[model samples]
Structures are given as C-alpha cells and as structure tokens.
Target: MNIVETQNLKKFFQSKKGTVKAVNGVSLNVIKGETLGIVGESGCGKTTLGRTILKLIKPTSGNIFFDEKHLFDLKLNPRKAKDILDNDGIDPKLRKSFEKNKYGLSADASVSKKGPNSWRIDDDRSTYLVKGEENSMKVYSVKDITDIDDKEMRKHRKKMNIVFQDPVSALNPQMTVYDHLNRPLVIHNMVSSEDEKLRKMVDILNTMGLKAEHLIRYPHELSGGQKQRVCIARALCLEPDFLVLDEPTSALDVSVQSKILKLLDRAKDKFDVSYMFISHNINLVRAISDRLGVMYLGKLVEIGETSDVFQNPKHPYTKGLFKSVPQPDPDKRVKAPLTGEVPSPVNPPKGCAFSPRCPHSKAVCERENPDLIEAYGRKIACHIFGKENF
Candidate 1:
C-alpha cells in the first residue's frame, strides 16, 4: 500500500525576470514501511519537494495523496481573487455577489481570492483543507484533511513528522534534552500525567542509547552524535507512521553516522514507519534505502530498487550520478562522470532539463521533453530509452 503519493505536483516561484520552476510535474509514491531515498545535487528541488509534501511550503499546483486520502488540491481562480485583497475593503454586498456567482460557491467549499491574478485556498482555513478548485470546491464527496479544522490538521501532522538535516539548528539551545523529548507528548496529549511523560521520555532516550543524565543537559552540552539521537527520539515520540528524514547523518562523524543509521534501521522495523530519506550521499543512500529515486533540475529522472539502480543505471543522469561515486581501490581509477553546469531553474529549457548536460543528447532530447518510461525493472525518463532510439 502507498502511504504517500503525488500526481503532477509543481511548485513555482515568480521572480522579477521570470518564474522559477523548483519542482515541476513530479509524481511518485512512498510505499508503506519502506524508505524511498531521493538523491540529487543541491538546487535540484529535492528539499523543496520534501517541504512541499509536508505542507511546510505550499505547492503552486498539484494533488498530494496521503494514506489513500487527498491532502491538497490547489488551483488558480481569477474571479474570486478580489475578496481576499483586503478583507476589510471589499463591499459587503458586492463581495457576496462575487462569492456566489463569479466563483461557483460549492456546497461548503471555500475559494479565497488572493491578489488579482490568483485564487488560492483560504489561508484562514485551518491549514489542511483539500479538494479545492476554482469553479466549485468539492465538499464532502472527497475527504481532504486540509478541509478539516485546525485541530484535525494537528492530528494528521502528528501522523507524519520531519527530521531535518541540521540537528543543531533543529534543536533549541535553551531547552534541555528532557524538554525536547517531552514536548511532543505534551502537545499531542499522549500521556495523562507528568510521571507517564517522564517515563515515556526516559524509555525513548534509552532506546536511542542515551542516559537519563543526558536528558537534563542542554543541546549545547551534548556532542554531535547525542544531539542527532535526541532529534530522532523527538520525531518518534509521537510514533509517526511516516517520517521525512533529510540527510540525518550527513553532519556527523563516520562512526557516529554508522551508529545513527543503525538506530534508524532498528526504529523503522520496531515502529513500522515509512521514510522519505533525502540525501546527496549515494553510498549512504545505497546502504539505507529499499528504493531510490534519482532527481535532476526539479524532476525525477529514474527510480527503482536500490540494487537494480546501482547495478544497471539507465538514465544518462542516473548513470552519471552512479559513476560519480568514489572507488576505494587505487587500481580502479576512473574519470569524472559528466560535464556541464546545471541550467538555471528560472528559465529551464523547453525540452528535458538534463539535455544540455547529457552526452547521449539527441536532437529530440533538446526539443521535446520525455515522459518517465518503465524499463529494466525501473522507471526512467530519457529520449535514449525509447525503442526507436535504441
């Protein structure tokens, strides 16, 4: 079963010069209880996609399905844009008319007009209402968590949590480890009494290989490894069904990294959690992921079982990424993988974004974008994969 899925998801940002396509038409899934590792260079929208899925950053347009329920459906509507301009300035009578006629006011769905050109979800709505369109927002037919009130969204947020890459910044310097570990319990009302909270906190700390003494110390007093373990413990405090782990071990020593990875591996099996693991370290990703997705210039170019992808990479970009991984022996030296700078996201090419950097770029690769096609027990997007090209 799929715990998370996306369809044609896109996130764009408007700039003085043009629009930047940070995450364009990305569609993928996270299977239940498996870690999906996303590997890509910096600025490829890997992080943006992660943040967008969690609703930390609203996507410009897309459908996000979580646990078989659509969580968000955002579209643009110009007609209802005026009412949201200045909530106070709109004429009461005129606003009512616009809300009813111009915008096909559905049964109970809301369409908040923003600025003059776009109609976004009512920011006033409890951050999660899903199933919204320009004409008529679908009301009860589809269960969208976004449509639920704030209290309900909080409940869903607890089901899914994110552990950021920077544990130092993610932790509070003023709060002690005990405070850090117990906050989730307090917020979620997980435990009835102080004793239960402390007991639960201590148990979690022990599982993460920390002593009760460490709980009283502040974030600064702990070593890098300890801080990361605390972050992991905090994320699991609620026992989330899905976790977004953003390079959790990149900042630690190799020894510490290995221990943290082991802890995460055990936690996943013990807690039955699904992970969307994002990292640039191919070797680490290879070791930890059940499946891997290769990303480039705001698009997923290839994805498959970790072993299959590493052994038989098909997409040129995927091939380059694998080739870039360092070899341990001096006798097995190789050249740099691929050459060419990543294109500017503000004005990506009309064709495949990797065309300029791809050695196998045919004329079609420069003129027409290719859809993700399945082959070699995986999905790949590249003109070279077409039967005619081969």
Candidate 2:
C-alpha cells in the first residue's frame, strides 16, 4: 500500500523580481515500508517538498493523498431548532422562548409578533421540541487538517513525525533531554502515568546509546551527536510509522556522522520506521537509501534504485554529483567537477532547467522541456534519454 502520494505538487513564492518556483510539478509515492531518500544540494527545495507533502505549507496547486484520502477536505453541518406552542400557531413570544431554550439565543431579544417567519417554520411539523433537549449545530467550516481542531490532528500526527536539521537549534535550550522526550509521550498519551513515561524515556535513551544520567542534561551540555539522538528519541516517542530525517548528521563530525548513520539503520529495523532521509551527502544516502532521487532546482532530474543510479547515472546532473565525490584510492585520478553554480530558482532556465550546466546541451535542449520518462526500471527527465535522441 502507498502510505503517501503527491501528484503534480507545485509551490510558488512571490518575490520582488518574479515568482520563485520552490516546488514545480513534482510527484512521488512512498510505499508502506520503504525509505525514499531525496538527495540534492542545499536550496534544491528538498525541505520545501517534504513540508509541502505534510501540508505544513499549502500547495499552490496539486493533490496529496494519504492512504487514498484527500487530507485537505473538511465539511461541516449546522442547524438551529425552535418550538411550536398552541393551536393558534406558535405565539411569536413563545417561539422566541423556544428558540432561546433550544439554541441558546440571547435572553433579551423580544420575539417579533409574526406568524411562522421563514427562519422559524419547517414545512414538515413532525420534529418535536422539549426543554433541555439537545439541539447541536456545527459552528465552523471543516478546515485543513493542520488548521482544524488540533486535538483531533494530534491523534493522526502520531503516524507522521519529523527530525529537522541542525540539532542544536532544533532542541530547546532550556529543556532537559528527559523533558524533551517525555513531552510528546504525555501530549500524545502514549504512557498512562509518570512511572511508565519515565520507563519509556529510559528505554528510548538506552536504545539511542545514551545513559539515564544523560536525561537530566540540557541541550547545550550534549555534543552534536548526542543532541541528534535526543531528537530521534523524541520522534520515536510517537511510535510514528513515517519519519522525515532532514540532514540529521550534517552538522556532526565525520566519525560521529558514521556512528549516527549506523544508529539510524539499526533503529529503522527495531522501530519499523520508514524515512524520507533528506541529505546532500551522496555516499551517506547511497549507503542507507533503497532508492535515490536526484533533485535540481525544485525538480527531480533522475530517480532510481541506489545501485543503478550510482553505477549508471542517466541525468547529467546526477553524473556530476557522483563524479564530484573524491575517490579515497590514490591510484585513481579525480574527474573534472561540474562547472557553474546552480541557477536562481526564481528565474529557472527555459525548457530543461539544467541545460545551462549540462555538457551535452543541444539547441533543442534549450527550447523544449523533457518529461520524466521510465526506462530500465528508472525514471529520468532528459532529452538525451528519449528514443529520438538515442
């Protein structure tokens, strides 16, 4: 089953010069039990796309379905009731009394001296009115899930959680590690009492390779790796089915990065958590992700299984990214790096977004956009991959 799906998702931001296409016509599906890695350089809209899927920012246009349901649709129904008194037809004053009692109307307003006003009478007179009988009405439109009744959304939030980039800034400076982990559990009612909460917190800390003593320490006291672990623990407290790991190790030391990656791998199996691991580290993403998506300037240029993508990258941009990673072996020579910086998202190049930097650029590449086509079990968006060019 597909747990999440976004179709033609687009998000545009108005700027002084022009509209910036932060996420432009992007679509992807995440299966129930697989981690889908979104790898790209910084400012490629990876984080924006993730947030858009979660409805943190409303899409300018497109559809997002979670488990085959339109997450944004909300409907409400409202009604008011009034009583009929006596055979001469309900006295206006008495009708007002009934309306007040049934609908909690203001006590001071005098009932207008009129028979069966359009607002009061139902053509079918069968509905009964009794004092204190419940007459309920919905007072508001059903809002987007995020803006709707927060108490209700909190129930569903347990299924999805995010561990943002920058652990130091993400964690509260004043909050103890224990308080950070326990807050979600208590808010979500994961544990019944303080005792169970403490137990769970300790277990989570242990699983993250932290001792009980670490719980009392504040964010500033912990190292980068330790702080990221706390963030992970906090996400785990919900027992979420999906997690968005936004560059969870980017700020850590090289040694600490490996340890954190290994910890994440172990935790995935232990918790059965599926991740949308967003990162700029190609090797780290290749090591952990089952599939790889190469995004450039808010668009995915290529996406395929990790092995195939690394071995035979179809997109020029993907090839550039792979070639740029330094080879450790002294015997092998380094390849030439990709030329030019990424183009401004506000004014992306016409036709192919990467045409300006693509070495194989042809006249047609600058005039016509390429669709993401499927071949060899992979999807690629490049004119060269088309049959005519081949």
Candidate 3:
C-alpha cells in the first residue's frame, strides 16, 4: 500500500523576476515500508517537493493523500449537493449506510464538521467523492486533506516528519537534545510525564548511538554527526510512518556519512517507517533506495526500480546524471557532461525542460513536453522512449 501519494502536485513562488515553478505537476508515491530516493541537481525542487508534501509550505494546487486519506479535499460544491440533501433529507437509513462504509460526510450529511477538510457531500460531479464498483457505492479510498486548517493538520503531523539536510540549522541553538525530542511528544501527548518523556528520549537516542547524558547538551555542544542523530531521533520520537530525509548525510564527513546511513537503515526496520530520501549522492541513493526518481527542472524525468534505473536509465537527463557520477579510479575518464545552463524555473522551456541540455534533442523535444510513459519496464518522460516511438 502507498503510505503517501501526490497527484499533479504543484508549488509556485512569486518573485520580482517571475513566478518560480519550484515543483511543476510532479506525481509520485512513497510505498509503505520502502525507501523512495529522489535525486536531481540543486534547485530542481527536491527539497521544495518534500516540504510541500509535508505541508510545511502549502502547495499552490494538487492533491496529497497520506495513508490513503487526502490531506485536504475542499473542492466540494455545497450548492450542487444542496438539492439532494434537501430532497432526500439525508434519510437515517442512508446516513447509516454511508457511515458503515466510511464514505460520505461525518455526522449530519447536510452539515460539515468544524474543519474545512471535511467531506461534505455524495454526488456524481463532486470532486470530493470517488464512486467505485459501478458507482453503486461512494467509496473514498482515503480522506482528502487538501485544504485542512493548521489546527486539524497538526493532528496528522505526528504521522509524518522531516529531517533536514543541515543538522546545524535544523536544531535550535538554545534547545537541548532532550527538549528537541520531547516537544513533539508533549504536543502530541505521547508521554505522560517528564520522567516518561526522558525514558522515551533515551530509548530513541540509544538507537542513534547516543547516550542519555547527551540529552542535556545543547546543539552547540554536539558534533556534526551527533546533531544529525538528534535530528533523526526527534523525527523518530513521533513514531512517524513516513520520513522525508532531505540529504540527511550531505553535511557529514565520509566516515560519519556511512554511520548515519547505517543508523537510518536500522531505524527504518526498528521504527517501521518509510522514507522519501532526497539527495544528490547518486551512489548513496542507489545503496539505500528500493526505487529511484530523477528530476530535472522541477519535474521527474524518470523513475523505476533502483537496479534497473542504474543499469539502464531511459531519460536523457537520467543518463547524464549517471555519467556524472565520479569513479574511484583516477584513469577512468568522465563521459560527456551535460552542457547548457539549466533553464530558469520562472520561464522554463516550452516543451521538454531538459531539451536545451539533451544531446539527442529533436524538433519534437523542443516543441512538445512529453508526459511520463511506461516503457522498458520503467517510467520515462522522453519522446525517444514514448509510446509513439515504440
């Protein structure tokens, strides 16, 4: 089952230059108990996409469903359902039927609950409803959380958490290690008392190779790796099902990086959490991820099983990324590096975002953006591998 899913999710920013399309219609999924590695050049919307899905920054548009339930689906038209509600009067029998199946509105069918994210109707044309089984039953595979208010969103926060790339900045200077891990537990009421919170923090810290004594030290007192461990510990304290690991080891040394990677691997099994590991380290991604996604200019150009993608990448952009990975041998020459400056997200290229830099670019690549299509047992967004060419 998919723990997290995004459909045509977009996030744009307005600057003096223009609207920056940080994430442009990217759709992907994080499977339950699997690591989905997302790799791309800097500023390709990797971090932005992670934050957007976590609702740290509200997306401009699109749907985000967590654990089959939408973060918010507030596009329901009250007027459209008004007639049905008025005429049928939300018969007690029908209301029970809706509740029994966990479909339709909660409580009174005509009235919505306190939050804006509530599903308020059951109709054919409504965006909130997902009719299934020949439209016989209004089945909502999961709740839509698109426009939920902050208060309601907080309730779901514990289920998902993020660990930033730079641990130094992610942690507060004044806050001690214990404080960092305890805050979420307290806010979510995961623990009953101070001693219980300390015990819980110690247990999580131990898993990260830290001791109870380190909990009293502030961020400044900890080394680079220690700080990251604390950051991971804080995220794990919530016992989240999903974690957006935004380059968790990039800031650490090579030796420390391996240790942290091992820690993350152990944590995955110990805590039963899924990770969306975002990084520029292709080797690390290949080592840890079950699946790989390559992004370019704010969109995924390719995605597939890690080994298959590494052995044979379909998208030109993905191929360039693999060629760029440095070999340990000094004599091994790097293949043709991708040329041409990356296009501005504010005014991206008309057709394919990578067309300007692709070696085998054609007139079609310059005029029409290709959608991700299934080919060669993987998803590729290139005219060369598109259905028409095949």
Candidate 4:
C-alpha cells in the first residue's frame, strides 16, 4: 500500500507583481518502505514539494492522501472544517489549517497502538471517505483538505515527519538534544514516563552511533555530522510511517556524509518508514533511492527506477542531468555543458517549462505543455516522447 500520495498537487505563492509558481502541478507517491528521491537544480521546487507533502507549505490546489485517508478533511478535524466553511475562502483556510495541524489536530491512526512504525487498526474496518471496496478510489472532492479544522490536524502529523536540509537551522540552539527529541514523544504520547523516553532516546542515538552523553549537549556543541544524526534521531522518535528527508546529508563533509548515509540505511528497517527524499546531489540520490524523479523548472519531467533514469533518460533535461553527474573516468565526449539560466518562476513561459533550455525543443515544445505519459515502464513529460498529439 502507498503510504503517501499527492494527486495534481500545486503550491503557488502570491507576490506584488504576480504569483510565484513554486510547485506547479506534481503527482507522485511514496510506497510502503520505499525511498522516492526527488532531484532538481536549486529552486526547482524540490524543497517546496517536500514541504507541501508535509503540509508545511499549503498547496494552492490538489489532494493529498495519507495511508488512503483524505488528509485534513472535515472528518479529521470538524472544528477546523467548520472554521474553513465559515470563512468561505478555500485556499487561505486549508493553508491556515495545515499551519496548526502538526500541533494537535485530529491525527487518527491507532496501532494496537504499538510496534516500530507499524500500526494496527483497533477495529476490523477503519473509517473511509467512501463506502466501497477496501482501498478503492473515492470521489475527489472528499480528498480536499479545505474543510478540515486546525485543532484536529495535529492528530495526523505524528505519522508523517521531515528532516530538513540544514540541520543547524532545523535544530534549536537553546535546546539540548534531549529537548529537541522529546517533543515528538510528548506530542505523540509515545512514552508514559520521562525515563522511558530517555531509554528510547538513548537507543535511537546509539543506533546512529551516538552516545547518551551527546543528548545533554546543545545543537551548537555538535559537529555537522552529529547535528544531522540528531535531526534524524528526532524524526525517528515519532516512529513515523512517512518521512520527508529534504537533503539530509548535503551540508556535511564527504566522510561525514557517508556515515549519515549508513545511518539512513540502518534506519529504514529500524523504523520501517517510507521516504520522500529530496536532494540536489545526483550521485548520492542515485546510490540511495529506490526510485528517482527528475524535476525541471518546478515540474517532474522524468520518473522511474533509479537505474533506468540514470541509464536511459528520455527527456532532454533528464539527459543533461545524467551527463552532469561526475563520472570517475576520462572525459571523452566534450559537448558544451548544458547552458541556460533557469526562467523566472514568477513568469514561466507558456509551453514546456524545460523548453527554453532544451537542446531538442521543437515548435510544439515552445507552444503547448506536454502531459506526463507512460514510456518504457516509466513516466516522461516531453512533447517529443509522449505517445500523444504532436
């Protein structure tokens, strides 16, 4: 079963001149215990897409489903739902609801409630948006989060968590590692006593090769690698089913990055968590990700098994990225580097977002955008490759 799925997800920020299309329209899923890596150049919405999936960035439109439940819907938080209904402005209310959802909204997953990152339905039949066969699709309207109440959103957040790109900023200088990691335990009611929390905390840290002594230290006291380990430890404290790891190892030394990567390897089984891993480091992503999605100018132009994407990229942009990955051997093919400035997100062109920079862009690529279509057991969003109208 898919742990998280977003359909036609879009998030745009308004500015004085116009809107900034940070995340245009993205559709993807993180299947159970799988790593879905998103790669793109800086400001191609990799971070924005991760944040939107975590609902930290309120989506302009689209449906986000968590473990098959319509996230932030009225059933999840009736009070927040009523509030949105009262306001009558769909966008702002859903956005506002998400802001409070992590604190204490209606998060409703019950395990026995037990085990690491695994949940057991207390009843034979859990609630569903539509009354039909198990795991069947419901009407899309029910998936909208606009009607959810703010107070109830938190109930849903414990199952999903994020470890951000910059561990220094993500951690609080004032708080000790214990303070940082303890909050999620408190929020999720994972432990009844402080000692239990401490035991679990120490165990988690130990798994990351950290000792109990480090728990008392502040974020500023730790090295870059240790800080990231602490960040990962904090995310694991919740035993989240889905984790959005946004460039978790980018800020460390090469050796340190390897250690952190090893920690992540151990974590997948220890936590049994699915991941939406976002990174700009293509090589690292290729090594770690089960599936890879290539993004260009705020759209996912290619997606498939990591090996397939690296070996047989269909889109021109995807090819450019593969070529750019540092090859250890001699540089034989000396084509000029893929060159062109990324277009302004505030005023993107009318056609394919990657057209301006594409080497094989045709008149159609400059006129109408292409839909993502299936090709070679993967998906490609290029007019030239899609099996559709030219």
Which one is best on lDDT?
3
Q: Write the per-residue lDDT of candidate 1 for residues 79-120, one digit (tens) a residue.
A: 343434324443444335435543333334344442223233
Error of 4 at 337 (Å): 2.4
Candidate order, lDDT descending = 3, 1, 4, 2
Q: What local distance difference test score does each model get? A: 0.77, 0.73, 0.81, 0.76
lDDT for predicted candidate 3 compared with the true structure: 0.81
Q: List model 4 lDDT by residue over 189-297, tens digit each.
A: 9999988989999999998889999989998899999999999999988888889999999888998998899889889888899888899999899989999999887
Quote the positional error of residue 179 for candidate 1 in Å.
1.1
Instruction: Kindly report which residue stretches of model 1 are placed more than 4 angstroms away from their true locations once superposed.
Output: 69-151, 386-389
Clashes of each: 4, 0, 12, 17
Candidate 3 lowest-lDDT run of ten: 111-120
Q: Model 3, range 115-182, lDDT digits (tens) per residue? A: 12223343432333322222132334544456789998998999999999999999999899878987
Model 4 sits at a Cα RMSD from the real structure of 10.4
| Highest TM-score scorer | 3
lDDT over C-alpha atoms for residue 385 of model 3: 60
Provide the RMSD of all predictions against the true structure, rounded to 1 decimal.
9.4, 14.4, 6.7, 10.4
Candidate 4 runs further than 4 Å off: 69-147, 330-334, 388-390
TM-score of 4: 0.80
- Name the weakest run of 10 consecutive residues (lDDT summed) in model 1: 138-147
**lDDT: the better of candidates 3 and 4:** 3
